[model samples]
Target: MIAPPARPDSLVRQDRFTTDESTADVAVVIVTYRNADSISTLVDSLRSEAAVSSIRVVVVDNNSGDGTASTLAAHDDVIVVAGEVNLGYAGAINVARSRIGATRAVLILNPDCVVQPGCVTALRAALREPGVVAAVPRLHDVDGRLSFSLRREPRLPATLVDAMLGARLPRRPVWASETIRDVAVYDRAHSIEWATGAAMMMSAGALDAVGPWDERFFLYSEETDYFRRLRSHGLVLYVPEARVEHTGGGSGSSQALSDLLTVNKIRYVQKYHARSFVTAFHAVTLFGEAVRCWSSKHRATYRAVARRHEWSNLLRAETPRPTECRDMGSVVIPAHNESRVIARTLDALADLAARGVVEVIVACNGCTDDTARIAAGRPGVRVLDLDVASKTAAMNGADEVAELWPRVYLDADVVITPAAVVDLVTALADGTLLAARPASRYDATGAGHLVRRYYRARSSLPLVRSHLWGAGCYALSEEGHARVGRFPDVVADDVVVDAAFATDEKIVVDTDPVVVLVPRTPAALIAVLSRNYSGNRDAPATTSSTGTLRHVAGTVHGPGTLLDAAVYCLFAALGRRASRRTSARWARDDTSRT
Candidate 1:
């Protein structure tokens, strides 16, 4: 296959088309909503176009319930399509075009658009070029400024940058976002990856070749995918001579639109990109959303994006063949007053603990809340309520009850994915690594400024490169557990476990991850850091950290990364100072417990 020729400095010039002399119909398809004012304005704009004779206008109303269909019905030539239910924009456009059957060209327009004089003439003329399948008019905002109507394919760095910092940065970076770079060609009539669906026209031949617009994409990226499909067969031209002023925020400003925009973006990426790229895309997008979510305006949207299951649904297999939880033995969780989040934690672990496959023990020690009651309520969970309030005692009690090889030490607040648990067990079955831990990702919802920056900075490091030093979930074979025997009376159980396993004996589960909840405020961060420092003082030196030369160089990402490092160091010093006041033997930071 040959590549398309390079676009010239300008589109090929053609004579203006005033009338349709050929026996073909030029159909105008408008998908409208609570857009009465725009529709009335569009009527006036369409009336002034002298060259658009014999054109048909069809309006597909998406249950706006605003009496828009009744108003459009009064027009003698307009076809009104009012339905009881809402078909999203792409679906509505499909309905409108299908109703206006066998058209020579279909011009799709948003209701809030005003066509300049001779605009339709220019677009129609451009469509007549040798191999051009579609044409889009140069679009400006209500104020006539160039909008970001053109695009390259959606990419990880570009989308993340656009989300974190809005497209128009004061000083553009060396790796500028796609939206920023696309501005250079906004004024030139040239080929593009895709133009906004708001004001684009498609030839009948193009529609026939590509079939109907994919309804799977309920709203956004429908046009992008459609244009991509069209480009696979023929060319798309941007006609600068033809101009349209768009009052852009139709579905855009709706509060409910954010979720749709997010899922559809993922859907587009998963459909087009490979699995490896999809995982990288999800990580970048989530971290960017998490950073920007600290702002009240975008908090809800980013929170939705932050849900791990949302990405796993698309990233993981649809029908995940149930994994065998491996022959290696028991799962032990130590809890103290964890009623609020214990249900979710155990719920995440239930499938793997099915019917004695793995002994599930929850050692609830000195809980002043209903944690013991709640954990005991789970079908496969065995809860033991001890008298003392100590994680060390709880672990010892759990070890006595479980008494099996390859024990899983887990925290009550963290949610361990069942599939990941199975994967870790299977990974250790080969006996190459004596002990293993699932890599962790911190859930940063409601985190303070310093804490937020820290996690976001940490996101740039390798996903599973760290050792199993202090992960939320780690498994130990009998040989591994014997190396670090019965729970020692220490501040951090994970620290002792890490000290026992050499770098070669421990494996970091890279495929599936374990999710942990991050502390909420700066004080909470200092508390956790203090305990960590106290725990490590008596423990062995860690063979892992976020301070490799590669990591330090990568930390030169923005002000945020540097700030994260600064804050992390400051808190470490503060924690060490604070640890002097607290008991070194028993310190577990549970600031996030509710």
Candidate 2:
């Protein structure tokens, strides 16, 4: 698996993005943080573009407490999404990309930049070139002079030269300088390694192929990383005719931002190059900062490079860190011979771990398969090999090791996204709620007709919606953990957690729904239901107070659902009978696993 780029809490919050669907051919996506005063000029400038009629303006305000919301509200034609938390530049761009629908191309612009007339038209023309995925516009400073926005890939030889003689060396040779300063190069369209991210255009296909921006650099090298990825698919063309006047010097001038810039340059090198090359790149970058230490920003950069191991801490200082409770939460996944599904579960949690959102521990019990190996390969995920083949034993073992509070216990087959996990963690952070889980979304695409009907009826029941037991994923705070103490040897671990909390103490978070896949065949469905029934029998007596009849009763309202309710009841009865007749053993539906 490709390692997720580590940015300072890039995925810190569940993005609260809302936008409209438009038939516009081009989407102008602007990611802004605290630039309310300057964004209006940029947005208004796009209105005068030659192809303004085909352009849909999308502004993603990254939780800027400034009046950016009010400033954007004035533009009725623009689509504005205000995030609840600061998702950094790359994260906000990702959110904006998701909302672009079927637009032909996306032009990413900084709020501080104004596009000249015909800029979008020229960019679209360049984007239409065969084998071209990205087109970057030539940027001019507010004073109307060219801002050397083009750059060469960071090479050890060029970096060393820059370190020996400062980066501003006017006549530095092309091979020794990282910046592309030849005036002739910007006079006409050409290909480039990368360009300044202030104004860049990409086809929608390029955006889809390149996937997400490497959010590891909160404000710096993310664009470089993305540009490199875009180059892998096709050419990154420079469109000199496309002019954008940029107002620089906000984050770029700050000492902290400069520190990040230096560190992220080294990070970009480390991600793509061998260790030997990364070592050389780091040494050169550090030397350059050391020589220029007279300036406060350079000193900050030097110190940042010196303490490279604490980069995450440095990033935390720059960005608002997640709540202490969020940092302290742990996700415990119990896997027993689950090689088939363990990777899927861990992949969901990888982003959470990369963002420092939670600690993940996968306790593999009696696994003859490669479950433990697969889980260990995931970033920020811990793996344990338990001797017994018991789910309760695995959970208990994981709980013993997980010192953090608000522990989330996830089933190996369940696929819960990082955003949904954040929602559950957020809900559990509330002083009143001790336990939480996301709403359930059952995938019964390949299930038998009767089984699908049974799930349809069962999913509509108020008891299922309100209870935390059926979701396969659930979280418990310290107090909630004390109530459930040690997981008993029961089939339904979720049921135990659910029973531990009173009605007011538990909640179902309204985030992205947790996808729960139903068994494919009728027999397989019954086998899973039978296992659930067996778990229910082993749960505390209080959990059984609500009888099967009561739950089935809620599924029936009119004649339409009456058939579904009957199927649900029949399955429940059959599962109960099967559970009573069969000896206590693990009975999972392997059909979905296959």
Candidate 3:
């Protein structure tokens, strides 16, 4: 007989630091992810707040690879729960709250945020008000600029209007926008539908009535789902007297997180609203993504919305099991004339190869230099001297010899650490995912001013870092290879591989990023972008040249991004024009290669 499905409570282990029998007036729960750098300041401020009121501090570390748990453990007044698995934000909050004693109110906080003097006291006071289920503090960035933290109930009309008119429209009708833009509204305490989850205080009774935060929403919309539930009980009050200095993006940002944020909005509507509303919400979301589908993130979201049944698995918190193989996998490096950069790249993988964690293969395709000798000199490294100069041909040649189930295709010029390769291999060991790549960290060292400015804008886009391409490396499971088939004879082989899989089938693994060196000069940068343009022209991408223009135009959020966008657009236009006029030969950037 088939058993019923299990509940999605993902917390496997919880540890309490303080065993005090005495209850506190409020419990402050901070969810951390590699936030050891900022956790000290937050803890210091909360320690000061403890002088005015009885407060119990609790920190739940969400399986951070950094020493966040150890840092929190050093605090005697704090209760720290070092999670074995990643219990996202909502699940971490639920876990932290369970360890608290009889507290009147519970405060949720981001690790990279700090509360000002009397802020917690104000929030606790506001939470105690009549008919108030939750209270939120006014949030500001480190620059002291006010954040539009409050939002209206996420309905179809607001979503549609925001999608059409965009969010920057002034004096927008309150019903047509989810974000509350009026500064006057933030001056005084008032009721709100919901606010940012970076910092909030909720009554213990309201929390109990609403039940635990829905962990299925994962990291993004779980708070929205909770607040919607809280509205049934009472109001969510905004306390202007309370302020939090937020160093946003503390937990980090990725294409996956951005896609999660977009898809979960529709998921929320689907949970409470009718079928028609759900369909409309989905359509509005797709329209928004469609408008910006040139952007990597929006393109990814468009794909996510297009594939409905698959994206729901992203909400699952089940951890991947370890594989039986002692040597994790094989790594294939495809090189043409990368002699200058091949040593550094091979040196980065030497430790992993020597440790028997990964077997390294360097496919030197049509190389005249000592690229083959440099790689062959390294222990546990195999060199394939291919006659053709095609990158895809080199990849296919290495694949013919690669015996591992999950194989990594690395560019000869990219530098990736052994730890990141191990993590990436572990992520693919379970065979649930088809493709994965570590995040990218671009080194702008020796880059010209125009090149620097162009990459500055490009790096700000979540898609450039999140997508499998551009990061200089991507891994594919045996199943992924079956789907992608053989390496195509195209300049945009990465694009072809990326297009073959849906958003759910691929991921940008959270690990040490591969280092991609920027072009040293503006001309070299344009030459590389010209190659990209040629590749995009040859490949079957979701975006077009016009879509690319709109995507770059859509990135202009304010004055700072405006200058960057202009530089980026100028280079993009030049690159496209150059690619059209030039021959179909590889317009490679020898600057970084040298």
**Could you say which candidate leads in lDDT?**
3
lDDT of candidate 1 vs native?
Answer: 0.71
Model 1, range 1-594, lDDT digits (tens) per residue? 999997653233111221233433467788987776678667556655533544667788887778777777666556788856666677677677657765778788899899888787788888898889899999888788887677778777777777677656724653456553445666677776787888888788887788766554657878888989989977899998889999888764644476557756766776567657876776776666677666764676665665433333222222112344344467888898888889998898786666555678999999999999998888878999999998879988988878566778888887877656665665566566788887677778888888887666555444323456546778887778778877777766776887687666876653355677888888888777777777777776653444443554554646766787666556656877888878754545566665
How large is the C-alpha RMSD of every model relative to the true structure? 15.3, 23.7, 14.1
TM-score of each: 0.49, 0.55, 0.52
Report lDDT (CA) for all predictions: 0.71, 0.79, 0.81
Instruction: Using lDDT as the measure, name the better of candidate 1 and candidate 3.
Output: 3
lDDT of 3 by residue, 1-594 (tens): 999786554221122222476777788888888998999889888866776767888888888979988887678778888888886787778778678778878888899898899998899888777899899999999999999999987778889888777767857878888999888899999998999889988888987898767665668888888888899999999999999999888858887787788888876776667656776888898898888866887788787775543453454343322222357889999998888999999898887787677888999999998989888999989999999998999999989988886889988889987756776776677787889887677788888888888987787663564368888889998899899989988887788888888766787765566889988998888788888888877777766667666766766758977989889989988888888888765876788866
Put down candidate 2 lDDT per residue, 1-594, tens digits, no spaces.
999877654243112122346456788899888898899888778876623436777888888898998999988777889888877888788778767776888889988998898898889899889999999999999899999999999988888888888657767789988888888888988899999899999999899898877554677889999999999999999998999999886443566676778888877876677657876787788888888878877887787876542454444212322333347589999899999988877887777776667899999999999999998888888889999999889999998898777788889999987766765765666457888887677888878899899888877665676678888899988888887788888787787778777666776664567788889988987788777777777776543435756756755758967999888888878888888887866688888885
The list of candidate 3 runs beyond 4 A from truth reads: 1-325, 462-466
TM-score: the better of candidates 2 and 3: 2
1 versus 2: better lDDT goes to: 2
| Cand. 2 TM to true fold | 0.55
* Pairs with backbone N, CA or C atoms under 3 Å apart (clashes), candidate 2: 6-216, 7-216
